[model samples]
Target chain A: MKPHPLAGALLIAGTVPIKDFPLLLGKAEREGDFLLVDGQRIPCTQGTAAMVTAAVAALDYLNLDPPMALLAGDVGEGRGSRAIYDFLSRELREFSPKVLSLHYLLPIITPMKKVISAVQGCNPRPVLIADAGSMYAAKAAGLATEFDVFTPDAGEMAFLADSEATHPAYIKRYLFEADSKEVPRLIGQAYGCGNAAQTLLVKGVVDYIARNGEILETVREPDVPQMEAIGGTGDTITGLVSAFLQAGLEPHEAAIIAAKANRMAGKYANPTPATRITEIIARFPEAFKDHLCEWSGVCTVESRLRPATGGARQGGEA
Target chain B: MGLFKDKSSSRGRGLTLFKEVKEALKAEKILKVSGYEVKLAAPPPSLRKGCDLAIEVDLMGQAGVERVLRQNGVEFDRIVSIDTEELEPLRVVKVTDFGDSMMVRAGNMKVAFEKATGIILNVSGGGCPDVPYLHLELLNKKITEAPRPCELGFTLCALMLDRALDEGVRIYEEARG
Candidate 1:
């Protein structure tokens, strides 16, 4: 089977690599004072998407056709590292992506339009697990509609469904405040590239995928003790969905694979709580292949997988 | 950029930390299954999710792991080792530790994490783009509501190596009994 040039979402996440104080990720978890990766010394700032983008962009410039990127950044010593977020938004826009995806975000929400414009797309949409602060901005920006989605856990869903916030200051305060605890009846909340893109995906026993006002697929993974608190699990899912977008699978389809893959990967790596993100991404093609083969009703290549291709190093003649 | 910082932490013991496990287990004789990447990890309270990342070794007695890495010429500016719990990366350990349990833990963690990812390749599934896979136990049984209404799934997948192995024993006992 010939592999499509565009596979699911081409994930792009970059992060800062400085004293990753609160969280020591992957190999970073090993060294208490210094940061290590793939068994070598690396600066701690390497954790954020901001720093990671240089490599991703280099890969892209190398003609890597990954459409979605998860620009990640770990906060350094500061009250709020908006600099990292703003820097990512700026640097990422230079890539001129068609659509922007958000996982854990916290820059100015209104400036999303400038981003969509720079990306040069007709209708830009963002996929996120909507948080209390982002919901109103989405609505007011005319992007909070059914086209957008929110992947939150039960608690988040219940919170969003009831038009509530976990805490008044759980996150930093913003202009749009709701008093009644009900999803406020705001004015002129239309769905645009930016408005409705912010969504909340509440991670839980039964995963519920929803958008503006309707529920999408509710994919269920096998129950495992590890699912309870894996950081970047949802981020990985988001990245997976983004990566598959290149293959032309619907967002939901990509999401299904990502969700399942993450779960399965979790199962495979059980007990080792600190699994690196890049390590798992390396297996995407095979996992995709197996999933298709297992679920194929009647097929040869199987409906789940088309030929897997990573181009250049993996197989394609770079 | 304000993603991983939290001041409230006492910088406590990372119970499920696998880096230490890898350091402890390096140099252990192990198997790196064919057509799969190696995963490494450390000891934990329980076998939930594991491995630092797998080093190449042959599942049929260590042929597969080395062959693949060599074949792929996997590049690394460095292959650093670290304490599994604190993530305090240790001075680079020799890559020769395929016979140690700690090494096995590190490599296994990598493999397990990598393997668990991705979607069903079938167009019926992967076509959904970024859909995430709902986790299915590799060896343990788990119940879930299927995509269809009232549809239930009993998966005996997610497993601990010992439990998964014990399951085989239990199956034999039941048949014999």
Candidate 2:
């Protein structure tokens, strides 16, 4: 098989907008203190912190060499981001990636009033990027456009796809509602053909890549069940796509491979009972490029890891 | 005051297993008891269901604890037992297998810090990051700085429980639901 060109030097990143209301269970109650998970009992505050830690923990699962590359979204105080960053520095000395780059747009944090640099202070990774609303955060930190490439989804595309912009003449923010046939034409002529090396990879039923404002390529995710509705699906997709890039696949190839793998993973989940998003995430790796793809009539169960330390892992650091 | 001493089995309404009552004892040590199994029940106006009572033995299995209860003419259905192998919050919460995931309800509990903004959260868990991650996804969105409490995870949860309560935030039933 021909190795996908345009591999490595790849950075993957995405953002998670935690739900505003805590998914608390019951009425609020006072004991001595603490607004609990149930409002009546457990203490489970700090939602964004949970996700950031999750990302940090996810890094532990990486099959890295050294200076393991880390890529995750950022907010001011870098509160959660800072923890992951620090964790990488302190604990994980064994298998670090040669470089680290974030694949996410920065977001503003309140109270700070100043735009927080979500991806600041990361070592060895030469680029710090901003997209959409995070653009303001990046610029505030004086690191806007430091990146070799900037990637965004459709919603972000509209924000940057203005005709006034130099590269992609038009970014299709409304791609969802836009007629399908017209999409290729608009993306190709207006978005993909632009002079900007900066790319926007919009995730949808069909993943589209627009670079320098030109439509680079499109790969439809084959047989991806309705997994998008369950939150964090996009984050996982972005992670995989970036992983392919970091693993030496071209941006476009990364998109295709990630889309296929995500679909296959979801397809794997469709039949199983108690299919937790967590379970699918854990079943990754061996399910992806690892185990041989066995096409049993029932479902393709990927080859699992040779029995080792313990057993198949429940994946991710987060 | 003299709960857990009654060993005499009184067969009556709301009969719960020894395991169930043991869990209730673990939950609210000073629970009011009634009927068979001595299940924990809150006073009226706080009718949270599933409040059964068992021997109110101190957390550590005292040497004469079981004997005292047996000696004292305490009426109960059966002696509840808990393996304690998987007791999550051993210091605060213990589960006696009640034939199912032990269900606990907080009674006479007041809404501690509901509409209060600007609180701090601290998360702790086993070396595994499942609960901490879930806690973060669920809690950290609302508060500030619920960082990893410690290097040793078990202690982190203990600290988290204590800190949240000290700050006037009422802790409630863990949101396993």
Candidate 3:
């Protein structure tokens, strides 16, 4: 049988407009952080950092001259999420994308559910990335295993830890205090509860890449002070990982590279809390170069610590 | 939370089974001969609308199973999916009348034909392998003279096409009345 025409295509579904961020596109418009792409507006709400990051990652992938077709859609609130499902269903039935990233859409459960069903209904299923609201929705719907990877921050990890809560905000007594310890606890509980996502990139001061609740690697370097205060860093990491997935890297490798590249980008930018997300996004190419060079042993670590270790960080670097 | 749980029994999440044991066995033999993995299990009481024995197969293999069953003359009650949530009902069929032609739609499946001449014009749908062939076979033929979907189709897709055609004819007759 012939393979699908879109076997390795990259399809990004985000709340943010594709045009709003520099995104390395020729033409764009911003409507309150939403990107206007081909006359359709994509929302870049606080919940959609994952997808926004994915689009940024695609820009870096394009630099590699791979046979990649990047398709982006806006799915903010319920409006775009609703339309996205119908479009997604039609696309899945015809062309099979390599990866489908779901950012935001947490507040609107119905549309996200429909998209999950659509993805499941596809023949050669696409690799799914869920972050922010989409991650919450997938886990809440009991369809978390349907996705390939999840990019969740400490707070979201705490939310996944709570078996009873429908949303992260409702997780009891865990808000604003999602430190590194809760990361594995959340993975263990989520796995015990039947989460099928094989890999999780828990974004934090020390990025932990865990497979089935077992911590595989930790990328803790190039830490930029006040990086947590700056928005879209998590989103950038999700995007970077997605790009690596599209490039055919395994989930663990992708997460490690993505975390290292994102931190490197931050270190190069050296942004205060005031540094805009676009400025950080623009540093991705440089980050990718430095991080890849380090991985390939082309670049020496001038600092005392290596970027990633197979287990937890050796010293308090972050 | 049991997304991948082996709920084939509790949820009736497998191939459609028949009330006739012969049909069920025949389906299993045919599927196995076709190189498909198939097993016979007692139907869950909740979903046992037909026979006692049901074929347990992966939901992903449904289209192939249906085609093989239809080709080998194996009858089934209905395909049961273990949906985690109650699915919204299939879209109600809609009939539209043009003075010389008519169109019928049920979900993604559609049937259109000329009213005055009864010449079938098109059959369109996706996500199923049979619909495209159904279009080829039904198109340009008189609706009354065309081969019935039950005779030609070997899967649920063929069943959907039959529904669209049946609805289209019913609406045509009502308009004539």
TM-score of chain A of each: 0.55, 0.49, 0.77
Candidate DockQ values, in order, are 0.01, 0.01, 0.01
TM-score of chain A of 3: 0.77
What is the lDDT for B20 in model 2?
A: 46
**What lDDT score goes with residue A125 in model 1?**
30
What digit string (tens of lDDT, one per residue) describes model 2 on residues A1-318? 332221113222222223122222121222322322232232212222222222222232333211122322222112333333333344223222222334222222221112122223323332332232233223222333343333343323332333322111112224323433444454444333241225445555566766555567776745453443233344445555444444334455545555555566667666221133443444455455442133111222122212111212353321
Q: In candidate 1 chain A, where is summed lDDT lowest over 10 consecutive residues?
A: A166-175
DockQ, prediction 2: 0.01
The window of 10 residues in a row where model 3 chain B has the poorest summed lDDT is B1-10
Write the residue-wise lDDT of candidate 2 on B1-177 in tens digits: 231122332210121223344454543332333211234433222222343343432211121232233344433333222322211111222111112111111110000122234232222111111223333433323323333222111112222233333332222223222
lDDT-wise, the better of 1 and 2 is 2
lDDT per residue as tens, model 1, A201-279:
3344555443443345555665543433232344445444444443334555545555675566556555232333343
What docking grade applies to model 2? Answer: incorrect
**Interface RMS deviation of candidate 3:** 19.2
Looking at candidate 2 chain A, the ten consecutive residues that score lowest on lDDT are A164-173
A1-318 per-residue lDDT for model 3 (tens digits): 776544545566644333223221112233445544445454432224334444544443333212232223231113334344446655565656667776543133445566777788766678888775567667766778788898876656655666654443234453324446667777787777765377899877678898887889887887774455444567668777776676556788778888888888788888654355556766766665545755634332223212211212233211
Q: What local lDDT does model 3 show for residue B104?
A: 68
Evaluate candidate 3 and give its CAPRI docking class based on DockQ.
Answer: incorrect
